[model samples]
Target: MTSDDVRHRREAGHFVRWALAQKIARDLSFPAVRWNGPSQAMDDEARWATARRLLHDDTLKSEDR
Candidate 1:
């Protein structure tokens, strides 16, 4: 790949890592606020957990292909 391609790929990877970190930070702090109600909060927590699992799980990655 060209230099631009490599730089773009690196930037994408950095963004993904940063986004994941932000999600984790939010997830950890979510329990402190109940503005959306407990049920909605629970749903949001579950969604984040599932997303994190799918992103990190090797078995799921293999199955996807």
Candidate 2:
């Protein structure tokens, strides 16, 4: 799930809604903080790059065991 920032700016379009919906689907039992505003204009490629980096970092850290 995203932080309060993402939630407050997710009503601009379907992508934000989709993202929020995905977050909601992850853990419905928890207190849901729904997004309700316009989505940020970001580069999808950059976002994916960041996600990849994070995943790789975690993977490498786990391999240190």
- Which candidate has the top score in TM-score? 1
How many Å off is the CA of 22 in candidate 1? 46
Cα displacement (angstroms), candidate 1, residue 55, comes to 0.4
Overlapping backbone residue pairs in candidate 1 total 0
With candidate 1 superimposed using the best TM-score fit, by how many Å does residue 28's alpha carbon deviate from the native? 52
Query: Which ten residues in a row are the worst by lDDT in model 2?
Result: 24-33
lDDT of 1 by residue, 3-64 (tens): 54454554555555676687843422211212454554457788899788888888775676
44: Cα error in model 2, Å:
0.6
Q: Can you tell me which runs of candidate 2 are displaced by over 4 Å? A: 1-40, 58-65
List residue ranges in candidate 1 displaced over 4 A: 1-42, 61-65
**Overall local distance difference test of candidate 1:** 0.56
